[model samples]
Target: MVAQQHGRRGAAFAAVTMAGAVAGVVATTGCSGEVGATADDRPAGGPRVVREAADVLLASGSSKARTSMEMAAGGTRVTIRGEGGYNFAERIGRLKVVLPRDPAGASEHRPITELVAPAALYMKNRGAGVPADKWVRVDATTLEDGNLVTGGATDPLAAAELLRAARNVTFVGSQDLAGTRVWHYRGVTDIGEAAKVASPFARGALNAAAKGFAKDVVPFDAYLDDEGRLRKVRHRFSYLNQGRTVDVASTTLLYAFGSAVSVQLPPAADIFAGKIGT
Candidate 1:
């Protein structure tokens, strides 16, 4: 299997899925007065601490996730299957992603897919292998426009901000997953119009961005263990055009960090090799 481009920002999709737990209650009430004003408004310290939590999760080991995303705007549903690993102390990581093909499109065409390993982003056009071409390379951290080559469409910057904007965290306590007790924190953020512009070819990605920006506040729910490790993240929202009652849920999970199997960015040359498939 080829390496994929699961940059730092992509990790946000996993870490902040439940960013609203802290603000979930308040978000439902609608934003009034100061947003993060209560005791919950303040961070444990600052962005660094929060970022540290993100980094720790990133550097941990072995992770597996099965996710389902429902989008009202496009009237589509997406399911994601993933497995990866991170060595925090070693700063190594790897992830694999597979997506379903468009039912309306040609059957000869393969589904859009991406693999983010220790190398560059390996995006496969599957059967479509025409015009659009193959893999490209960009910063391991951010997906600037210049980095786009082909295979799959992704925007790193927009994704990162989505995670960064999460604030007003609270210890929602702990829960057991895979036999381990994990601590949970929740928060919220309004990305404003920025989300509308950060389209990543995926409805769930776009909806997450737009909801974060338009709602002027997106809620998140996150879980971590006694060792301060992130276990799960979930995001929820109401479909605006699909009747006020229509609601949606998007979630991501992280596990087994700092383990031997953890994957990290590969050599720069391997990322932009232009290879489309295995």
Candidate 2:
């Protein structure tokens, strides 16, 4: 992720500028009966099960998603929340993101609607002098973090796809999350490795992220249901800010599988082409 600019400016505009600046597959070979085994039933170890998360979500179709991005900078921490839905099969998602209030508490920011698609991110109500009705588009690969942390909310599908690079994974145990039983797993992942195996739509951006972040290693925690579907995921990301490392924790939750998710990208005419304000 590009270094986020920090100042008295509200988090909304800072996020917009940080964003405007820059910016999975599986194989199974085995006996016919073994092929039917769920991830939990596989004996290859935790990493195998966790690595298959993206494919599981894709097979599940669509789902309702909730995202939270927490950033710590200059001795202050703020959290951004988002609610929306994602079409895993189509690799597109829409999120309504609510930025934190100004540090002085003088004003509340309007919610920004974000569209996450292949190689591009679109935002409405992005502020920073753009018209409310116009969308600002940024190429995902251009972002240092690949839009992972820059947009204030991680893309739902990207979060899952990141698990494709899971390594040193260990089964943390089982727990109930929101009334659903899930198996927990913890480990670290490599962005470059993930990009190599990620789906065509996500490969380019992850590849960019691999070279952009200060470090390629990302620690993560993941939870999955009995059917091998991803229930929740959390990633810890770090990037350089003014020569100091800033930490960002991004979490994504999935539910209501098969939910109808419709995301239509804005037409070219509706995308703001003028310079974005800082």
- In order, the Cα lDDT scores of the candidates are 0.38, 0.75
Q: What's the TM-score of every candidate structure? A: 0.49, 0.85
| Each model's total of backbone clashes | 41, 9
lDDT of 2 by residue, 60-112 (tens): 88998888877754456677878899998888999988877766778877888
The CA lDDT at 12 in model 1 is: 26
Report RMSD (Å) for each prediction in the order shown: 11.3, 8.0
Q: Which of the numbered candidates is closest to the native, going by highest TM-score? A: 2
Alpha-carbon deviation at 257 in model 1, angstroms? 2.9
Candidate 1 C-alpha lDDT tens digits along 141-227: 232112111112222212223445566766554446556665556677545432343223222333433532224465767655555
Clashes of 2: 9
Task: Give candidate 2 regions above 4 Å deviation.
Answer: 1-45
As a TM-score, model 1 comes out at: 0.49
Worst 10 residues of 1 by lDDT: 19-28
Error of 2 at 59 (Å): 1.2
